[model samples]
Target: MATEVTTLVEETSAVKPNGGVTLPIYMDNHATTPVDPRVLEEMLPYFTGKFGNAASRNHSFGWAGEEAVETARERIAKLIGATTKEIVFTSGATESDNLAIKGVAEMYREKGNHIITAVTEHKAVLDTCKRLEKYGYRVTYLPVQKDGLVDLDDLKRAIDDKTILVTIMAANNEIGVLQPIAEIGKLCHEKGVIFHTDATQAVGKVPIDVAKQNLDLVSISAHKMYGPKGVGALYVRRKSPRVQLSPIIDGGGHERGMRSGTLNVAAGIPSACRVAR
Candidate 1:
């Protein structure tokens, strides 16, 4: 898969003034997949003819791009049973993971400072937890069973009054083992703690109903499901406890100010469209 992605990147990068790069076989769907030519066609007009900033609403161009972005948001929300207002666009799973974890942590610090998670989560989740530890937040890294599953009892035991959040992955990226997210979410809810999952590896391949699972937050990546790269989203359940996140970077207030900067309507819209499928 890595080799195929490398080949595609090499070919795409080699396009000259007069000719396009030719791919040999196109078999690397794991590391990355080829962008659907149809999606590219749909996107071409935005880059040339109707280019406009979604954040800018003073002109027709801005309205057109903003409408497209909202339509894409609705499509993505439909896939996971979330409202469009709950989704926040991001750079990819890594950024989504960081936002979900750190956002909730900072938001709920006054309520508690401890967080719980398993050992087998993607580095994004684990590393974010570790960083929190350095800042006076306590993290409980739960152990997984031999089957690569987190024991529900262990998760229950890890929870304490100080544990404000629980983050886990929806599926194992290395082994494709689906976690019992519904069960885990139920457990968190029972204890009045927030639940978050990194669903980058499981989004398109597995069915995820955020409400059924009682997920407070979930992360997704676009490129994982034949969509454009550098775009993803995080689902933050509105009913969940309010979370405060100090922005890792600051710019124009966007994404409700939880994530700031100009919106990438082009990539965000197509990415959401792919996930809706």
Candidate 2:
């Protein structure tokens, strides 16, 4: 049976209001974006004949599915200045933030039980720190300056021998303020702590070079960049102090055992589109 679809979004750039402003306008792009037509066009094949489980190893169907994911990954890697192997797909930035924080905390528990982040960080990060506190881990929620940027001096003072990870966001989703990610990454590297940035609002809009910034892990979302929802990726540095994470999920061991789930074949390609092939 063929199901009819509704066209909710206006394809035209914008409709003018009654001499006020654009009508039917989506004001907060920081939160999300309508999927681009190009992305949708690219993803149509996978839902039909190309449909297959990426985890299936013996069939041509599986091969097609895996190729789509890999191609999508290559585009994601290129957008963020990362290697294809460094990208780990996830449900979204929230999960990416959790994986980066909790993964580091659990994997290096013997080394340290302390983590640091800013007061202005995304809830995924700040709340994860709070949860860690309940688990007997120490957390430092650094204060932001009047301009809404993390205080570098405060951050330096907060880093102690036990601090294992530092999670900060590259851009503020609410205020649209840019953080000093480069400086923070350099500082974290000097202090020998892992640096994770929620670049959901920054990746496609700005130039973020993981190596140049000395960043260890970066969280990226597709919906924020005119792609679809329900998918995201994390960049975990592989060398120059390869970052390790303890898997929060356990099953088929997809996503290199970090996040285990049947890869969202259709949603993934478009979700990571523009960021994907």
Q: Which prediction has the highest TM-score against the true structure?
A: 2
TM-score of 1: 0.87
Q: What lDDT does each candidate get?
A: 0.82, 0.86
Cα error of candidate 1 at position 27, Å: 5.4
1-277: candidate 2 lDDT, tens digit per residue = 1232223233344565667977766678887887778777777888999999988899999998998888878788777778889989999899999999999999999999989898888899999999999999999988888899988999999999999999989999999788999999999998899999999999878888898998899998878887778888889999987999998878989989999998877764434446433
Look at candidate 2 and tell me the lDDT of residue 24.
Answer: 67
lDDT string, candidate 1, 25-113, tens digits: 56556566656666666667878766888888799999988887787788788888889988888888899999988888877778899
Estimate the Cα RMSD of every predicted model relative to the unseen true structure.
6.3, 3.8
The C-alpha TM-scores of every prediction are: 0.87, 0.91
